[model samples]
Target: DSQKEANGLRTDHWVMDKRHSTYLFFMGVGEYAIVKDKWKNIAVDYYIEKEYEPYAKQIYGNTPEMIEFFSKKLGYDYPWAKYAQISGRDYVSGAMENTTATLHGSDILQKPGQLIDENKWEDTIAHELFHHWFGDLVTAESWSNLTVNESFANYSEYLWNEYKYGKDQADYHQMEDVNHYIHNPSDFKKDLVRFDYASREDVFDLVTYQKGGGILHMLRNYLGDDAFFAGMNDYLKTYEYKNAEAHQLRLSFEKVSGKDLNWFFNQWYFGSGHPKLNYSYTFEPVKKQVTVIVNQSQELPFEFPLTIDVYDNGKPKRQQVWVNAAAKNTFSFDVSKNPDLVNINADGILVADITETKTPEQNLMQFTGSKEFKSRYSALTAIKDQVGKNPAATKLLSAALKDPYFRVRQKALELMDLSNADQLKALGADVEKLASNDPKTLVQGAAIAALAKTKDKKYLSVFEKGVNAVSNSVKANSVAAVLAVDPSKANTLADKIDLEGASDELLSQMLPIIVKNKVTSEMSNIAPLVAFYPFLKFQNPELGKSAEEGYNWIMTSDNLKATESVTKILGQAKGQMGENPQVKMMISQMLKDGLTKKMELLKQNPQKASSINPQIDAINKAIENFK
Candidate 1:
């Protein structure tokens, strides 16, 4: 490690040297392997050349299948000869589908408990892989055409996920993120153009991926699968080996579907906004039945599904609808002679804000409607949103807690606000239930946090059981989540949780979960966290101050080379000021780190300095201040 800092060598550099050119390359190295060495067919010893091992293994593992999967699916064969991808340790954005390489945030990878769930990390792998055909094989012409690259991958991920793990799994991911994005179409938080603006990583915003996928889904539903696939095939066939503008795609799709999609595409993609669909329902006592009205919200008018729920005397009567873009629309399903209530967006389709005007008994009919996972998932979410006033939401939330898909359960974990005692206890019970039923890494972590979130003393045993005998990531996520809820117990559990043989990355991830727990504020609140984990030392004034900005060069004291020159500023330099210990350390590290980062950037194209600017300025300032 010390020699690596002085030599200006890093893993990414070795990978670039392996790759013939910079045009089709972007490299990242981290521990977010969904299933480490799951691709052993192409596994090369990352230790032989060591730094070049990850990119090489990635290239080797996905080479044949990833290439073949698209060739047949896209109605075309592989365009690029090679593909590579990696994950960053702190990358917050979803995942980047760089030309030949896909870069994901390090947060996604887990050793069982670090994250809320694992399906996402797995799906991320598949999703980016699908992009091998969509975004990468067929490049988007401009930034505006980002949906072309993203939506296809998003929908493809759903399609492939369903193909791989049933529709239930896909629905959990799509319906949550995509539907959320649709509901708040203009929610810039999930920016579609996570590309041009913000930071390089910020391009992984929710808009393009989630809403982009949602819009594709709407288009798929609108065009029907046959037409959709035909259009997709034609889109790629026509635009393959070249760039495609959004208008070009809209025109081609129109040709394929024989239906003008100007309105649909503009409302959802081109425009920077969401449409509102209004839903209203009333019981017509005079007519001896109930009446429900569903329409788009004046704000947020992105077209999607609108499923209505009917109840006769408050008993759920099955009824579903596919509401397209209509300002004022009404559809009457059979109702009992004395229907008592009506629910619009009963299926929670169509992007809109729904106001509930019914009881849980009445809502339960919709809540547990048809036992369909998607609807049940939505109803559970609805219950969670109203957990404060509606006690029945607990049961609905409980049902969601038992959802089959790890992803759905993950959402239930995120959505359920653990404020009330009953709700909190319910949350803890659900986590424990999952801990027993679903032993996977992601779900286990979510369960740990949910149980911990309760902060209920009675739930300590559950936390103890879940926290004990888990992976570093899982234990970290669980311990962190638990600490957030009940720090005292979390501390006790932490003391019991082992960190032996854990990596620095895992330690960094787990330490935060142990320290600064939101559940309590006192050192006593986080005593266990402060005790067991050594990465907690990052919170130390020395390392904390140095690593505050997250610039790889600054923190490592080597731009991208892994040097530790920042030691000079602290008077640890062995020579005079610039030639002094601190300066020498910084220079040694910077030259090495710079060579790695700058070389990678240069390979990507030195013309775009912004790519390396974040690193460059970060390094310059870290050293410039020393002078």
Candidate 2:
């Protein structure tokens, strides 16, 4: 955790290798740590590490329990001989099921002496373990066959989370995405099936997890639960210890279900876009029926369930129907009462945008009035921008803000965006208390962040005081809160805080905040000015032209201070980065872009032109590019 590395210390890096039996086997140390516990299991010792030791232990203990749980449920023994889970420190790439070892980003790693929400942590642990059977034991042959790997892993998480934490906690709509789940075309230049991911960051996207998992769940609903698991068993038996692609998996399921499933995968996965619907129908009281015609178009071609809530005298009665085929999926409901409104997915069943038509105001009033904690929580989550104006409108929410659920209390604390600083401080203090009570990291982190944003000096002092006293995780949280409000605090702490012989945790804490602060406050200003999304630096044929143009525009803008920083950032690009060809090209193009800027500046502001090294160097580099 030292602030500076010892002179000549060797920094380790990772590259993909095919030397192992696993789909991806990786090794790295120093800045990149794999913190799994090593154990003696048969001939070869097993080493497993997560972001933290306690979380690793927790994950380890649960693996055997989950293995036993699934084995009994499936009437089959655990497939893998030895299991290990290693959580990445800030796992932007996502959790991977690599043979006996499963790796997840370490941001989810819970610290020792920190109280954790039993449900959420366990669900993540369970989700990865479920992969032992579906992904590790029987691997996907190619990344293109994403359905076999991600769908199974994701659905397994949902089933386990639902069973353990209830259907609400298995909430995909808000926590994840509703649009991608229903296949919205708004962001489909990045296709769900045929991948074009430039980096690992894009692989763990919602299209892979939420969309894939939701479709798989629907598949189970279409086929009986018995048939679904039986199909899984058949698929596993057919392709154990080997890689099978998407078509192979479809064939396996098709055999067990005795149904042609090619159309199912093709329509959903291979297709260009999703279904969108627009409809209107009036209820006739004499007929004692609710007749609603559904209108759809191939704009989305989405086939997901739409629940209609029939309200009579401000009370709701719910029913579900399929909004199938983008063309027009229509059905009618008959009842003695003429319903005031029809709400689609009122309970947030399927993840889709609420754009068809507005639900009844009375139903919303009832929802806001009810004391059901989940209802109040849902309303608060759904109304992000509208809540502040309708504070009185949300009865259950106002009451829920005082409710026992720590998350509920925290959310209530968050809504105190009053113009008065004292009001914000009061809410911040309450959130500080709730942070101790709530074991949820997201809630606690959100509370701390919101409190820090108050920008009051007294609040900053309170946060600093909290950091000085609390245990590591709690202290780290307070530090994070302070950093969010004023990144300079982290820099100040880095300058003052002694890192010499400090524990890895302390260094770990400092490095990320420092890098993040630098990225936002420092480097971001610098990167775009001197460089193009440049071919010499980050050369993707697709993005190079746009990035280059964007950088040129930024440099010519009137921000002189930014212009100075940009020159320095571009200077770094003149040298080598790594063997990655794209990296080289991007650096060159950025330098080239910077050179053009120097030529203009040389005539406009000659002294400033000489002051900026990259600009001067860039002027030379531009000529070299053409030469």
Candidate 3:
């Protein structure tokens, strides 16, 4: 142990083996309660705030179980002396894995009531722990190959969820990542194993984390779980306590699976883009066969493998096909019976942009009958986009409102558009029930916001109660519902809520409402919204963008008093926000932009120019100070 200080600060000191990298060293000093447990011969400790001591088991009691699972799953012993995790306030990232000790954000300290939904720490906690084996023990050769460290850690979330929370949760987690990756392909135009990054931080992106994890998932599905795990154990054993590159990992998997993987690596890891695909299928009932043609729209086409399932009166028969490395590929499969509906990406293995052409009847069947949540989710989402109201689709949406999964119910709420008088008549009662009684806050919030569109005064009580609810998410969204029903009440409601404890959701929701209604007459209430400045500009840049637009709207609202108040707010921020260069730059830009707009307004109407010249001059002086 490091020397105990004279003041007794309860410092923790843990040494790392010389083989590990220099960055793996860990130490912390704080007022924390240490909870201890053991997995075989390895000791585990969780250090948290004293106030959170009672909920320690709910928060991190699974550290020992996780260690045991990962050790056995990877066929690797616990490499470090002992393991420790602590929570810190205002942590920059979610969590950081240091050799023997991990530091997490204060959000990990949750009360027992928060666990009624699901363990918030499930993915992140398992992610950091997996780094001990993949990153801390083996290490990546260089910043260029960060996916070597991060990809495995990202994949470990799936492994842990599968081992502990069943495949439904694990598959749902993977579908979320795949959705993030496929929907946001612009972020991953660079090769996964690229070497020309401008900065190391640029390497830690959705591509390295989510896309790489999705690729590993495809690999696991490509080679069965046994082969994939065997390959993983071999790779870890070969690269233990030594830095390794992408090729070394490929060679290990290739050695265990006894198959060449250069084709897979060249198309995915070393490659630059994924396949944006669209497909159409034609079934010939007389021959009991289906012919599917897939077209690639990406600049660089990828040869992606897929399992196409043909449902014959609800019984599924699957056939493997490849969207070959070309502009377009075709496949035909002989079925045992006439197919009722076709499911694309049946296993949801590969991350690609896949659109399958199907009729409304086929979509309704998939939404009701598909076993996988992603399939049902995709079906319902596609149905939501259709223009005409089909009674069959509406019936499916009504039934899906009671889906066991919250996301499914949320989608059902979104698809139940009350703007359509037909839909309003069919599902209004069900929507009211969901708004009041849905178990998930997100679903309830969605239902309440949607119900507001009906202009039903009876649901006003639900919105009023939700606006004052304990959950910040519910309160923020309910505020939106209230504003939707009666825009006149925004100013009074804005004054009542405590802005200090309000979330970005509330700020982002209410900022536009208050600005639209010219609610900041006294300017005293505006200060709380201004506190969000400089900080929110980076933390939630979109909300920050919205704040900028709202501020611009206020300045040009033609109310000199309100415009003057905004000017004073910017002037106050000029001095207090100069420490952060980014914040300083943003404030300067806003001042300059606001000044230019004010000058333009004065040009349009010379009568009021004289009244506002002093304020304009003051803003110009503030701009000079920024220089």
Candidate 4:
């Protein structure tokens, strides 16, 4: 409650509803530009920085629609008094669900140019909003069963994408989620719900988020949407404003669907590791039957439903089979003729690792004949290594450049080896055309990157135009292409590019160029560049190396103005890092190490210490103040 006094001062009071988890309680006190909107008489607001007042609507405008969609989808109304999202400076996490108020990172404040391309945080918005039902209303009983809170929120990204965009976008998002889990083979050893984790933070890993979401997707596919959503609605209602566990969730689904799901809950939730499947088929012309063999190589066998599509004469016949707890299983299907292709896990719904034996011709047939994005994507991945060596593979790669899905087209562009002159000759024109005219900026950026491998000057004009594109990805790629063609324009292009709405892809591309070209004009943008250090250091090592190079250049640059700007920026960063002690220590140590290396260099070359001493002293002082 806020009331203005006769003296012209306002008093505000906040009183949160009872029964909410302490973790979901949040309070924000700061000067904010409150952008007002509403959903069916309920207040929906965005609190952002004053400078981003105009873009407040653009950044969070869909929030109201998202609330409406989630409420209707969950068969529940927005239960709180109001909903507010506040963007905090240097926020630690992406976003958090706090009953009626959510907190987001300052990066959520975007410029008009960034929104022109895409609202990258839309999925995040949906994720946190869905938590209103899954995390807030029905809280997880324990950290051991965090999937009850996080998995649903993670799957909400796919759900919202499917509803708002389409299945392809959702499938692509799911594919990335699956990849994030699978990339670290060690994580596969952990169960979705484990009681023996070392720390509460240990539960918040890929298994809880990505793999858990994939399991829910498979469960949804198995139960069908009607029963799945019905069960979800029932669960939320039963446990609203209370705590629930994974078993209770399963019980809700079982009650709604009238099917015992112990096999699923036992194996997926309680068990560790996924099935490693090797699928092959043998054609028996005499019996007019194809025998499909699936071998599980993992130590423990998994019992799950598997789909196989037998293509005969360019038409598919779907076969659903259950693989029990066995090392090997075989199923024979009577066919009219030799099967054209035997595609396992046909819908690409399963989260397991599958190696299917298929010829190049079969892969191409699957790529063209299959309607699903994952199937087509799998086919492309299968033949990616054969692009330059095999004629059919080369043809498939060329055809995929025009695939209906932008991700497919982008994948094809990524797979193409444009460094080979013959391959470039075959696909250069198509690549250039996509670079110039593709509807998706991501695909266009990829096409531009593919062309950059050639280092040909003829495509300079295309790159120059791309520098002015609305998408940061396109602009960054174009600047890279420009650098490849003419190295002299590095500093000029670096100065022209705006870092206000830059994406990680843009930063990754430009940091190397900035360092290699000694482009010190980007000193004012040092905050974001410095902020990116921790993320890159842990998540992306190659980019982290480039950032290290940039840091070294800044600390030791011959340019006095560049060094002075960095000193000021480091001091400001130290002040801002007060809230994040870990980051402060990390930066402080980095500065100490850098000073050590510079001192060694000065000692080795005594004549250079006169010029280097002042720079070294500035970094030392910054480190001392940082402490």
Indicate which candidate wins on TM-score.
Answer: 4
Q: Scored by CA lDDT, what does every candidate get?
A: 0.55, 0.55, 0.76, 0.84
Expressed as tens digits, the lDDT of each residue in 110-177 for candidate 4 is 87667766787888888888898999989999999999999999999999899988998999999999
> Which runs of model 2 end up more than 4 angstroms from their true locations?
1-55, 58-61, 70-75, 86-95, 103-110, 113-128, 172-206, 247-263, 278-281, 300-305, 324-326, 335-340, 347-351, 356-378, 399-412, 418-627
Which ten-residue region of model 2 has the weakest summed lDDT? Answer: 38-47
Tens digit per residue, CA lDDT, model 3, 393-463: 78778777877777788878866778778887778888888887888776777788778777667778999
- What TM-score does structure 4 among the candidates reach? 0.86
Q: Which stretches of model 4 miss by more than 4 angstroms?
A: 4-10, 419-421, 499-508, 524-549, 557-590, 596-627
Q: Candidate 3: lDDT of 108?
A: 84
Ranking by TM-score: 4, 3, 1, 2
For residue 373, model 2's alpha carbon misses the true position, in angstroms, by: 11
Cα-based RMSD of the predictions, in order? Answer: 11.9, 10.6, 7.8, 5.7
lDDT of 4 at 16: 70
Please report how far candidate 4 places residue 489 from its true position, in Å.
3.5
Query: How much is 590 displaced in model 1, in angstroms?
Result: 26
Off by over 4 Å in 3: 2-13, 30-43, 49-61, 87-94, 105-122, 164-166, 183-189, 299-301, 311-316, 335-340, 419-421, 460-469, 475-507, 510-627
Instruction: Quote each prediction's TM-score.
Output: 0.62, 0.61, 0.76, 0.86
